[model samples]
Target: MYQGIRIAGFGGQGVISAGILLAQAGVEDKKNASWLPSYGPEMRGGTANCSVVISDGEVYTPIVSAPDTVIIMNEPSLPKFEPLLKKGGLMIINSSLINSRPTRTDITVVCVPCNKIAEELGMDRIANLVALGAFIKKTGAVTLTSVEHAMKKVYKRAKPEMLELNKKALQAGYDAVK
Candidate 1:
């Protein structure tokens, strides 16, 4: 199986972190994975995105020009990445921040209230994790267990409570999808 994913959002929205976690999860699952990140000059509140490729065999490249799945975390990202999705791809939009909807009919769109769910979980920063959970549920690119295991490496300095909260956020996202 192979998945080319592009996750886009503002800088502080954990777009890069989410990509890292996904690639790490692939490693935890003993799969081939690569992550390439791009961002604007500003640190916070700037446009940020990452391309992640996960496959059971070798990964040909880290760049994903036409992604199988696109996770849009903000309003601007919707327009920026929507057209880059492969035909019949999946688009996971964070509806809490993005009010506009995609106009494309060739792809499937799943709108998740990522920020709303994260806030309900006690932190809005975990919205990316929530989105990740939805992606996992929809694509099965990697398992929840692998993602949790990957947190150890990606979020090396996280406290136990924070980890637990993250896990909860993921599960909530997963359950939210179906």
Candidate 2:
């Protein structure tokens, strides 16, 4: 299976980190994966996005012009990437930050109040992980086990407390979608 995922949001929202986690999960599961990230000059508030291609075969490029799945965390990202989502794609929207809904009918839209949910979990910073959890659950591109393993490896340098918090956020997001 080939899954091209684009996760976009403003800077400091963990957009890049989420992409990295996805690619790591794919690699942990023995799949071919690539991640390409880009961001605006402004660090915290500017736009940021990353494309992740996960397949059972070779991936020639990291670019994803038309993603089969998109996770948009802000209003600006919606307008920028919605049009590029492939027909019958999966659009996981952060309803807590994005007020408007997509007008397109061909794609399946799953709205999760990521920020709200994260706030409820006592850490708004983990909102991106929540979105990632939803994406992983909905797409089945990567297993939760793989993501958990990646978290342990990727965040081993992080605060001991944060690693647990992050895992909770991921599980919360996955459960939120169901």
Candidate 3:
């Protein structure tokens, strides 16, 4: 199966961490994976993107020239990546910030009002987790439990208290789509 995926959004939105979580989950499943991000100057505004690859064999390039899946969390991401998504690919969009829709019927798109949903939950920062939850549910790249496990591994050293709140945010995102 096509395993290359790209997640793009604003810098502070957690796209980088989401990419790391995907890579960690792949490692947990014993699959070959790589996570690459664009982090030079356009950190928060100009451009912010991450490429993640998960496969049964070794990965070649970390830069995803064309991705099998695209998770777009802002309006800018759509124009940035719509032309790069492969045919019959999948896209999970954050409906909270973006309004334009992908024109291709060959690709699947799932819109999650992540920021609004998280805001309603009293935590606007968890919007990233909400987007992550929708991405996981839409792609099934890894199980929710696997994502949670990967999350603990991600936050244990840096932000332990964030784990529970992010997990709850993920659950809320799941419920929003369900």
Top model number, TM-score = 1
- Give the candidates in order of TM-score, highest first: 1, 2, 3
Candidate 2: where are CA atoms >4 Å away? 42-44
Name the weakest run of 10 consecutive residues (lDDT summed) in model 1.
39-48
Worst 10 residues of 2 by lDDT: 38-47
Candidate 3 off by > 4 Å: 158-161
Q: Which candidate achieves the best lDDT against the true structure?
A: 1
- Tell me the tens digit of each residue's lDDT in model 2 across 1-178: 9999999999989999999999999999999999999865735686799999999999999999999999999998998899999999999999999999999999999999999989998989999999988998899999888998898877769887888888889998999987
TM-score, one value per model: 0.97, 0.96, 0.91
Candidate 3, residues 1-178, lDDT tens digits: the string is: 4488898888888888889988897888777889998899879476588999988888988889889999898888898898899998888889999989988888888889999999987888789888878777777776678778888787777575677788888888777775
* lDDT (Cα, tens digit) per residue for candidate 1, span 50-100: 999999999989999999999999998899999999999999999999999
After best superposition, candidate 2 residue 139: deviation in angstroms? 0.6
Off by over 4 Å in 1: 42-44
Q: lDDT of all the models against the reference?
A: 0.95, 0.92, 0.84
Clash number for each model: 0, 0, 0
